[model samples]
Target: MRREFKLPDVGEGLTEAEIVRWLVKPGDQVKVKQNVVEIETAKSIVELPIPWDGVVAALMADEGQTVDVGLPIIAVDTAEPGVPAGGAAGTAVGTAAGAAPGEAIKALADDMVPRPPAEGAVEPGAHGSPAPKEERQAVLVGYGVKTGATKRRPRKAPAPPAAAPAAPAIPAAPVANPSRVEVTAHPVPARVAVLAKPPVRKLAKDLGVDLAAVTGTGPEGSITREDVRAAAEIVAQPEPRPARVAAPAGAEERVPVKGVRRMTAQAMVGSAFTAPHVTEFLQVDVTETMNAVARLRAMPDFADVKVSPLLLVARAVVTAARRHPMINSSWDEEAQEIVVKHYVNLGIAAATPRGLVVPNVKNAHELSLPELARSLGELAETARAGRTQPAEMAGGTITITNVGVFGVDAGTPILNPGEAAILAFGQVRDMPWVVGGELAVRKVTTLALSFDHRIVDGELGSLFLRDVGAMLEDPLRMLAWS
Candidate 1:
């Protein structure tokens, strides 16, 4: 019996995904829970596993194709005809092989199709509300029974292929239709098959490295961006050719804004326009916090952990939010109310090659000093690795963007969408400061707080910012304030 597998909704509010690669092609045998495809959504890459054991029949989607959720992407032949449809083997097959061929096929599809979750099924959202039909139905395949609509969902217009390096525009050839001239240029270059992750691929492309020529140095002989850059330095530079003509100035290059970049653009535009932003800046002496960070690093509890000033800043923000709950809140325009969160989902804005992604530590207000340090370490590692899950990026109440990592002093940052406030941490530098009414060299850093005017007034925002700054200045105030 043949069964079709629809593209599953792997994340909340995911509408479509770009098919990155196919692990199994037509004519391959597949096992239960075997990964069949690698897909890129707006946020991250996911490996989707097929739930049933079968012989691959057809690949419904092509690599690089953007497919809508709930659309069939592959068909499989279960091909077991001797067993009863309702028996254990039949259940595993998703339909009875004993039934007539046509009947079995239809029955298998009917039983295998993803369906809306029935009552009492766990939904896939932060609030535990029932997810959309697409999300709920995806879970049906995890179990033996199937539950979605048999018909494939309508697909959007096919996405154009990724943009490539452009050749210089040439003069058009004369055509029969005098109004229309056909311009001919260089043929499109073939894409090289490389085993690097999406972020590494983006890095290599930005560095203008040919992945096929670069040697792999990562685990399992995978190509790393470092290797690509090293290869580019050795081979990418070319001597000037007398016959080569340089392209004209101001010739625009096309870049496809998809995946993380696309999503980030949309989000930033929405947040900038929707929120009435008010930014406040504060400069504080963080020498005490730096000393505390060094102390923690030498401690037995933190000996194995990576400790940084960002952890101290994060903990300070959480402590300040606890004192001023309004800072950790969202504007519920639909409900026409200001929602204050008692707990903090502290978002740390991380910049990646793909774009800016903010993955938060859940219940950060509840974590101990060492636990927060560990969480911050893990969060940064996962984010840089491009393995941050959708759930980790969701439900952030407040955020901290450490622009200091990039040697930036301070900048007014846009608030993360749905959140009321975002704090930007500037680089710590040695500057002359007034301590005990005497000017002395001290470690100083600036903090810029941007908040939604509707949620946080001038006085409340100032108080919150001051509290965080005070904690960093003294480090002991973090404990007192907590």
Candidate 2:
């Protein structure tokens, strides 16, 4: 018995996923719930598990190929060990035990000889096959007679034209024993496997470039797109110009957008166009907030977690959102109303190798200061490692993008889709400030808040920004507000 495990919807309503790698190869025995493959969807990378215990028969999809949900990616055979499927072993054993010598020899010859297909027969995936390549039926291994299909071989040169008619050749004498047979052995030419990804291979095929002849410049000598394109250009030239210099490897490159980067691009474009954005900036003296962070770091409660200015900044935002709930709400166009969220799923935008992923802390408004700091630390660590899940990114009511880490002053950031407001925290530095009518150097930072004008008007946006700045300027304000 054989069973197929299709690619399931690992993420919420994901339609497709790219196979990143195969953990289990053909002939490997796998148990139920054992991870077999890792795949990357639009949101994140996830590992998939097999559903039944069996030996892997085949890998239906190639790595780097994006497969649709519910399509079988692997086949597993459930038959017992040492027993071939379809009673092939039983037949072979029975033939060797009771069959006559001639009959047994005949059976062995039939198995060894390559037989041509019947007239009008078409091989799978060949022209005039019963079904198209995408809809072809999958066959189990070791179940029936083998097909004549084989791996691709180099094309042979055309034979010379036939000569004019001549005298008939004499026949050779037959062997003394009729059952005796003589077979000639032919050496097969070894083919070197091309080292190129699926996309690069496709590009070479489309450009009519032979990968075997082209030199690979990619890591580990894998062929890249630029190498294929260069080969194609060389072939396209009418004549080789020895004086012509070849272009540098890094002169041009193309990257395919597919995973998290693609999703971020689409979301940013949609949010930028759909939401009418209104930004407000305010420069605040955060000397007191810096002092408070230093104090919290020494305390026993905060000894285990990291204490940074961003932690206080997150706390301030939560406090301000509680005062002005409208800033944390989203505008529902279909409902034609402002949807205010009572709980804040505060999102922190982290720049990862993949892209900008905003994995938020759920119910941030309800967490204490120390709990919020720990959550922020965990979220940052998870995003940096590229392990943030899809669910962790969803349901964000408000977001804070800490541009301060990059040593930037401020930025008018676009809002995350479905969220009404996004706050930008700038770098803190010692600047001239007028405290009690005296100019003195103090730690100051800028805060830029961009919100949807449809729900949060100018007054509400300003109030929210001012409240957050005030809480940061005087950390005691958070105690009073709470």
Instruction: Give me the candidate number with maximum lDDT.
Output: 2
Residues 1-482, candidate 1, lDDT per residue (tens digit)? 66667776677756568888899877899998899988888887778888779898767666877765655677688865555655664464443334433344334432343333434333322223333342124444323223443344344544666977765444465446654545466566643344554446776886788777777886446676679877777765665446756668777576878887788898999899999999999999999999998889899999878999999999999999999999999999999999999999999999987788999999998999889989999999988888787789989999999999899999999999999999999999999999999999999999999999999999999999999999999989988889
State candidate 2's TM-score. 0.66
| Model 1 pairs in collision | 85-96, 113-148, 114-147, 114-148, 115-147, 115-148
The models' CA-based lDDT, in order, is 0.79, 0.80
CA-only RMSD, every prediction: 16.9, 16.7
RMSD of 1: 16.9
TM-score of each: 0.67, 0.66
- Report the number of clashing residue pairs per model: 6, 0
